[model samples]
Target: MSTAPQGTTGGKTGPARETFSSRKLFIISAIGSAVGLGNIWRFPYVAYENGGGAFLIPYLAALLSAGIPLLFLDYAVGHKFRGSAPLAYRRLNRGAEVLGWWQVLVCCVIAIYYAVIIGWAAMYTWFSVTKAWGDDAEAFFFGEYLQAPEEPALGFDFVPGVVYPLLAVWILTIVIMVAGVRKGISRANVIFMPMLLVMFLVLVATSLTLPGAMDGLNAFFTPDWEALAHPGVWAAAYGHIFFSLSVAFGIMITYSSYLKRKTDLTGSGMVVAFSNSGFEILAGIGVFAAIGFMAFTAGSTVEDTAVAGIGLAFIAFPTLVSQAPLGSLIGVLFFGSLVFAGLTSLISILEVIVAAVQDKLGWARVKASLAVSVPVALISLVLLPTTTGLFVLDISDAFVNQFGILAGALVAVVVLAWVLRKLPMLSGHLNRISSVKMRTTWMVLVAGVVPVVLAYILVNEIIAKVSEPYAGYPAWMLNTFGWGMSIGLVVLAVLLTLIPWGSGSKDKHDPEYEAIRAAEDKEEAR
Candidate 1:
């Protein structure tokens, strides 16, 4: 209920919020966040696994029903409140501020390991010249390059190859964040996004010319219509759309909080959602085409060569580069695209943490940026660039994405729909500012459909993980890195909310807050 002093840009605010220079900048930066390493590395394999070309039906349906609706909700909340997640949520219901902190904490945990992946991309960008991964790409990536230990619990032992590049990545991220939102994040995306598209297109074009490209495309697009009936396929479609769009992570909310008042919230959400999914489709074509070439070389089928996550990016792709015509050049373009995609996404993730610190503590932007970045950088340098880094990163990524991001989002929807009963007001806000007006259907999706789907995903994933150790890793490893980190994040979020909100005025005492309260009181009286 606290508010900023007079002269703030928004009528109700706690701190001075940053705005993107234009709608174009906001959309591009948003697309950059959405079109990340997952688009290139995760989506192709997900499609191949989940009914191939027919996966598109469920994926697009999820986008419409869940993805875009949640996106529009986040945009509406942020723009209407004119603050970061914590401040924005606090305005809605003071007790719900912890939800925002939970999201920011999730972003911090993600940022810690995400930087390490960007570092790997950086190293590979150089390694592309010589195909340094050599003949056994898998062995080279896991054994020589990463020096992965025999066990997940082996602990950190720094590898110089990864540590140096990781340090460089952290430095680059800190520099961009320090430059402020419009000057740093916006401008960087202007350059990175278009370049990413051009490089990816070039790689895709080259991949299609390779021998057996059609076999890869066939493996990718050939549909098994029966797979649509399976509950798991629909779940995978929803999960991919959710994660790929970067919702439920506070990235979209924070980014939207930086927009001008008159911006089209629904139109912007549509652009970001469609742009992200479109890029994923393009990535599927490119990835499968390259995999086909690899299969042709190995005398195997595209299905045999298929993989996902880090393996697909660092191992399968490198092996393809070593065998393909103009292998070195292709390698450069491929990894270079990864570097750009990872950097832009990294910037967006870091911005969430930085914005939270500034909003809560009234800290200068530089101080906030450095305060969060320095510790995370040190952690990355000491732990993530080490022998057991990949195992740690893998476990942490799975838990944080499932437990942290999704759970926080579910809480938000329940509070808005059932607890506060604010969905109608939020829908009204979106309709007022957007060219594409939201209807009751949009409200149903946000308040009812999306939350139900997310809750199912959360419960189903938890049951699956508890019933069996994930990926056959030891129980201790899952307990330590997976469940342990997730529990720690929740504890941290609660602890953060206990800190007194340092806004200059008392809660529920600010003029704007009183006015809102008065209006609600009148509505109830009527």
Candidate 2:
């Protein structure tokens, strides 16, 4: 068959061919994009930190109101356009392709650091096998693996740690992705996603059997109504929802671009969101159950039993694994499973960079992937300076994870919700294939309530942080700097909105834009 319709085409193609069914492909792609590190690590932490059970209320609320509706909007953009972000936006709004380019830039930056984290996971897997972590295991795990070390500390220098491994794994990721979506990404997910679920189930089963597992589960599920009263908790819930759902990052746009137009928008979004949230809930159960087990056996509190940082997954999880029947065998499987999860995510991250380079530069996928891989490797090297590398990774992650994603999401929501008047189209598409229509309540939620809530989060978070005192700087001036830094992403997004993209002669006839009538015409012809 012909190569997939990737880049934008010049001539009219009668509403680009739909080789795949949207309902089937979109579900897979959406799940692939959503089920990443956020569900595994970030969601549990935010949920646990934000009053555990209390966080659930706002989280589910956002899921129903903001997350699902917004996700449907993203899926509609991608599936409707049958192109990646750059071309997708070019179809929607000629001027807003700046948003497209911005999305690309953000993905590129995040991918640079994401590779290092995956490499760290790889390094941890090796360490697990060899049991080579010695007395300095804690430092090695954190300094070397968790945080990239800098300058004359253990595992110092970028090349030995960050640069080479990142390059190697990224190249590997590119190879998987370059194999094309169906055989490469989809096939891998079909295999790896099941494995992740199985491993997770086994872990959960074992944890529940542990002495205090039920207690920990209760702590997790037990209601803490007062916790919901805290603004910070609500903010954390919203942030986690965005992060876990993989909204705002352009991944959904990119991945969904591969989807066929007839996909069940509402149902697929629900599946993706619910499945990912289920995994997070499962992971939480396993994490806290293990925490309870370790605490009871070791005579420690849950806080004391719990280990944070990179070592937790490697050293701590392995400790639990070692105690299981066939400990070494299970340990290998656990870390091995983590490697697959990490790799799957790593490739998706790399694909963002690859897709962006191809769109902007018009290079072939393989060439673009290779070009991006080199710079990413060099950047990863920055994390090799003792534990300083690790620290930088965290800083980079923090910026992109919340600020970058939230900002991009804000733009996306504004574009789709306001600029495009996309909700009605989304509803119409879903109403066609779906048995049940998404309630009108969601339209109000997406356009009015969600944006206001996101804006509140954006402002309150920055202001709250800015008001805090810090050392070694003039407090007032430094506070101003803090405020600026916090709102930096929002400012960057606003700046992009001011710019516009060059439109093609075909702009007015964009099959993906105001061409629903034309789409139907093409369908009738087919």
Candidate 3:
């Protein structure tokens, strides 16, 4: 009767087995992951620090060469196998399976800390909307909530009251995960993403009306070539590009696994990447416009650029809101937007871990979701009690984000683009619906050039951070410990590829794989 659901024939693993097209979900999931904390806080500061307008040069360069290419590569690998990242490697090359699991492991570490920060954003948003605390809100946040001893002191203390909001955020995330991909994640993104876009546009429009907005625009756009000479600028640009685009994380790979066979992988990846870049540009306008207006009025130097984090929102934004008309209402909407952005990204992170559990353990979706949630909640609880939980998030983010993410990305590029012959097949499949095509040489660049650049960035970052030590490492060994952790991840990926996994002799799983395929076919025909 009905010509079978569109994707059902690809097997239980195919996206058609669910109600959402991987293409649609991919866009939602990709956008959800992209528009988060970094977009709002980090990009403006990094640009300001890295020669203002000149930073755009390398950043846009990276978007084309590094960010977009890898995005397509990840989607191709995931959708081709229709399995979790680790299992995708096992299917493609048995030895490479070790590399895949390493990636999955990175996601495990990142997702835990990510949930804690998302909880923090949620608490901020809640406070914003209800005007719950009023004028006392700032004091309550920095004083009672953050437990700083006094204004601007930045001292840390434990607050027993912090656990309640953290628990609320954790529970909310779990509920979303329990809904499964189609109903929960996909549907929510379809709604939230459009709202995010509209709200951002509104923010940008209002910002332009602020006097001295053009001054800020020039500061961001007019390039100073000298910045390009400094390697650190390049490194910052590369890292920001990766972070903003949400590449090299298992999030993209995990999202792609749910994709359908007929979906245009290249097209989808391009759309997500381009859309993300558009948001970054818009975010840049909104942030700098305000910064510019403030600088113009306050007589602050361009060099006196502020650093990244919720501090920008908590301190700078509130200051701005306090000065502007309808300050409280605008502040509420701004932070509320951030809460949604954080939640959407949080949802994707939880989904990656949940998908891994469901596949590996053969658990139902609900159990897998819960199993993943409990452990993360425990980790969040550890940080929730300390005012320096933000500090822990920073440390974990550095080790996992800068070192772990870069390493994971380099490995993925090497394995897929070079060793696995990713581009030729990937390009052939993806180019069918596209105008521009990836050449073999392009794949080689992705495999070779990109990793080399990433490797350079990783090393330089270690030197720069250790040499400077923004917060000052307590001892020499602390610096040593950080390097060891970073290097160990790279070494681990290399070692696993060298070992033998019984030469594929123990069991023939292809029959089981094929049986699943046949069931998928029958389901499609139904």
Candidate 4:
């Protein structure tokens, strides 16, 4: 075992690891990562579809039992091991390095497709001004705007509108990553997260003023007690929580690795978890209020107009923008929020890859950021920003998230908790530095409980995807992008771990890691 001061690693052993300058920045940055595209566009509809107000019970339960618990788990591992995912897990135990790579590759896949969605949002933010979709929103989106082919082939017929903004997004991401953690991530979150919040709040306020806003609010909050009795709703809560908090995909692990040694690990986790959830609830309010207004004007039921994902954001909202008074303002606010939220989350996702590369290659921060991002950006530009990109985006997101992130997470908890039996050690690390101490209950939940839920989710997803073609795509298409991509990620990750680690990573040499190991060894001997 070895020991040395942190933040003292000088040039060329890889740029000295950077940290969030304060707990406040760390918390804000974490929130920014967590409150992403899913929070704004996906959550409102998820809550609405699942029991509405009653869904909160299971949602809160999932947050407490799994979300923050897993949050603590990531913080303890990264902060204690004090490196990127691969480095930290390798330091945890040589056998565990692959888990980190799996997560990094997952982030890489996500970052590429994620940028294109942000590009769409950025374009729509401009489209808001003139109600560009005009009389038929769906027609404009699918036909004139995207110009997606009648068939979803992996085509390279580039859509200039989509490519331009996506290119801009990648360029901006490169600049930020080159800025490093404090200057890049922290500052981006500090600026953008608040702007996102203020903008969304204004959106919600304006949404509330729409003629039938209360109807939407009522629809959102009105609880169906029966939905709770079904297990699927509970599963949905846990599922959404996992994605919403950006766990299991290496983002939190990498982010937590940047935290100061003496930081309040659990306290910060709490702030991030709650703030993300609060923002989600607020998003539900804003989205449904507008939907309610749309329903009112169309003389239709709320359920008829309510939708989620791309439909809600592009098709439905654009229609609302066409109809609502000061319509353009609402569109700007909503789409701007999406652009900001997506960027914050996108940068965080890419950082997992950037940080891992920096640690693995022992490259300087700027070198690693460019080395990782440029190739990734190039891949995104080639694959996305084309006629069939939305299909690619949808399928890649579905399979990668389910198999790559969800399965990787399940494997991580099982290995760390059961196989390696590291929960005690990891829990001890948290209790030592955290404001809120970890009780044995934390171990039970992380080890005994969360895995069961994750296993269920993962199994169901696999069964469903295998049994039926995802999104009704051609079998070959699904096989190539959907199944092939997910399976390839795991194989690639294992291969990546075989590459030799850089000497400059040096996290294993951290004094704190040595101290923790020494204590564990002494306790075992005793």
Candidate 5:
């Protein structure tokens, strides 16, 4: 159907949906979405903590057997159905529309907290010049900078420093989202992705020249070959790859929905997947190298200094900046990379929600962008810049990521593959025009292997989180932000699915899709 030539259309009610001007732009944009802060700040720690060099084996296996296959699955559904996540799933099977809304609500929770991190990175890029976190990096980060109080108690006391930067970040995000597909997303990818690669390359080179750099390198690469036998290690590999690639949620599906009918989806999936992993490897090198310098200064080991997420970005790297030669340069490049990588991923996450709203309400791109994003920005502003913001971010991230993304993904594959039985049709759509074919092998991976990995990861997460209060927060905080937030998304998703789609929804009976289906049907009959 994808390969069929164009013909007359009959069902569209509004202007044609936007498309990527070229496949090159689509690939760049997809890679931009995939390569995010986790690549720079989180992957190195995951690799080191998992199995050092031996982690690559499981990571590669997970990428091939799960990540890429699931990516292809997302591409197939979005391209074939020609709609946003809810719309696409609705088109696939009416009962499945709830899954789409589930993914969108997940993005909503993610977007609210995610922007604050990006804002932090943007500010730190400048603080690098002044060495603002003087003396004790930890004290400054927690005390003067974040102003986070000792307890996890509730408060709306906004820190002016964080509020200003966060406001700037939201404004920038809204401007890009309002610009529409080609003008907004594709162009940002072209500008930001290249800049990210080059800046990160320089950061890596500079980190390698730091004193004790070889020690960090050795620690990072010294395969604790024994670690490979652990199922937990392999599970970590599979779990991180899902988050790293930005799959299972709605990001990839919404992005692919904008492609031209005959796009080379599977081939593009391969490029995006490998490129994302490649960036992760580079990040491990640079981060560990910097960690080595920190260890050298402290007369400790790289293992002592190595950390991930907020601690790695704000605390560890700041200490490195104060001590190492060319430290200021390292801080600038590293935080700058975070800013670029973070913006790209945040843009993609928000698009999943905005596009879903657009499809349901049938609004113009600008109206939809403002309607959805303004409320999102307001929520983020009100909730996340306060003194207790970090606690909320941490607890919410633990719950939402595990239940919303991991559990939600598990549900999607099971329902689509086992219940509705849609993989065969989606596979056919991929094989029709994709340079890489999806036949029995792709089917087995998506329908059989992918769900099992997701389910294993989900169950383990549930057990661990339920068994203990995450990050040692009080019961009230965990119950409100973590459990309550995840459950609320599910309930809202069901309610959203019940509402009728608006008249302006272009794909209610998509003419482009039907025309191609009819042409392919005629061809198949012949």
Candidate 6:
């Protein structure tokens, strides 16, 4: 195993990895990655379904035990190794190189579908004006807007409505990613994140003024406490926290690799974790408030109007916009926030793929970005823009989140904690650089509690899928798009690892390699 020293250029072997321009830039960029559609679109709905207010108990619990700790683990590995996921893992244990590639490939898969969702948001941002979704928001979104097919299958028939916006999304993402980390991602986040928060706050304020806003707030916070006892609710909380925090998909690891050597790893993780959760709570208030308004207008209850994921974003929100005071302005603010959130997340996802390629193949940043982005763009334009694209996206998102990311995180924890026995050393590294030192409890959560909980979630998901087709989709659909895609990722990961690690001037000769090796030896001796 080899390691690259902090701030050293790989020279002939790899392009020099760039550090973030400042600590503030790093934290902002990281928060941009963590606070995405998951918070605004997914969290509210997951909370509503799980226990409304009661879900917060398990959600925060998962955050403390699993989310923040795993984030710290990612930070320690990348900051210590000063490389991408594959490089970091390879340096840790040559045999575990495949785990790194697995996460990278998972990001690649996520990028394609994620871009499509962003494209949808992009289109909705424009459609917000004049209430283009018309009177029947659900029908307009599903039928007139998407023209979703009667059945799901791979088809190339492009929907111009979807394609045009999707094209714009790819172009925007490419420009930012090609610009390099500090100038592109960090700068973009600085502008996008604050603006997103302001617009969302305004939306929440307006919703509070609407009739029945209290009802919506009540439904959102009023938890079904009994639901907390259900294992499924706990699983959902962990799953939501995992996806919402954006860990185990190579994004955090790659971003941490760009941090300066003196950066505070644990403090950064805590900021990102808490910032992400705080935003979700805000989104919940805004979302449910709006939903309550919708129910009031329709002479119904909050439960009747409540939705999640794409439905909440496109259908329910658009409907509320049409009926709200200053309908057009409110609509713009709502959809615009989605675009900002989605763009930041999309850039982070693409960077994970770009970083992995640059490290493995020694490609320049622009070249690596293009190499990964082109294929993903083609997929989004060709497959995801079709009328049936949403269906494909739905199944793909479910499978990837459940099997791809959760499985990857589970493996990473096992390797670092059990196989390599590096949890203590990793914690020590965090304490050294961070103002907020990690206690033994963090180690217990990362090495013991987190892994067990993650395993339970994975096993439960597998059993549910095996017992019946997911969401009542056809067996072949689940088998092909769901199971097939998850298996394909593993195959791709193994194949990627088989490629020879390229040659370079600083490949195996960096001083950091010896330093890390010495640390590991000392730990093992203890």
The candidates, ranked best first by TM-score, are 5, 4, 6, 1, 3, 2
Segments of candidate 5 deviating more than 4 angstroms: 1-13, 520-526
Positional deviation of residue 174's Cα in model 1 after best superposition, in angstroms: 0.4
lDDT of 4 by residue, 1-526 (tens): 0123442244433355678888898899899899899998899899999999999999999999999899889988888787889988998899899999999999988998999999999999999998888899999998888889887777789899898999999999899999988888888888998899899999999999999988998999999999999989999999999999999888889988887677789988988999999999999999999999999999998998898899999999999999999999999999999999999999999999998987887678888999999999999999898888889888899989899989999999999999999998888878875788997999999998899999999889888988889878998888888899988998998999889766565552344546656764575566
The parts of candidate 4 lying over 4 Å away from their true place are: 1-13, 507-526
Q: Residue-wise lDDT of candidate 2 within 56-140, one digit each (tens)?
A: 8889887877787777766666666645676677667766676765666666666666666666666656655665555455665
Q: What do the candidate models score in CA lDDT, each in turn?
A: 0.85, 0.62, 0.68, 0.89, 0.89, 0.84
Residue pairs with colliding backbones in model 5 are none
Clashes within 3 Å, all models in order: 0, 12, 2, 0, 0, 1
Q: Root-mean-square deviation of each candidate, in angstroms?
A: 3.7, 4.8, 5.6, 2.8, 2.6, 3.1
User: Which of 3 and 5 is the better model by lDDT?
Assistant: 5
Residue-level lDDT for 361 in candidate 2: 46
Q: Compared with the true structure, what per-residue lDDT tens digits does model 1 show for residues 1-526? A: 1122332222333334567978989999999999999999999999999999999999999999999998888897777776678877888788888888898989888898998898898899888897888889889998999999766666667899998998999888889999888778988999899999999999999999999989999999999899999989999999888899998778888998888766888888888888898899999999999999999999998878999989898999889888899888788888899999999999999998888887777666788899998998897788788788888898899999999888888988898888998888888778865789998999888888898889999999999989989988988888888999899988998899899755532232344434444664465466
* Span of 10 residues, lowest total lDDT, candidate 2: 12-21
Candidate 1 regions off by >4 Å? Answer: 1-15, 503-526
Which 10 residues in a row give candidate 3 its minimum summed lDDT?
1-10
* Residue pairs whose backbone atoms clash in candidate 3: 11-520, 53-220
Model 6 agreement with the true structure over 483-506: per-residue lDDT tens digits: 999999999999988888655422
lDDT at 519 for candidate 4? 68
Query: Which candidate number would show the highest TM-score if scored against the true structure?
Result: 5
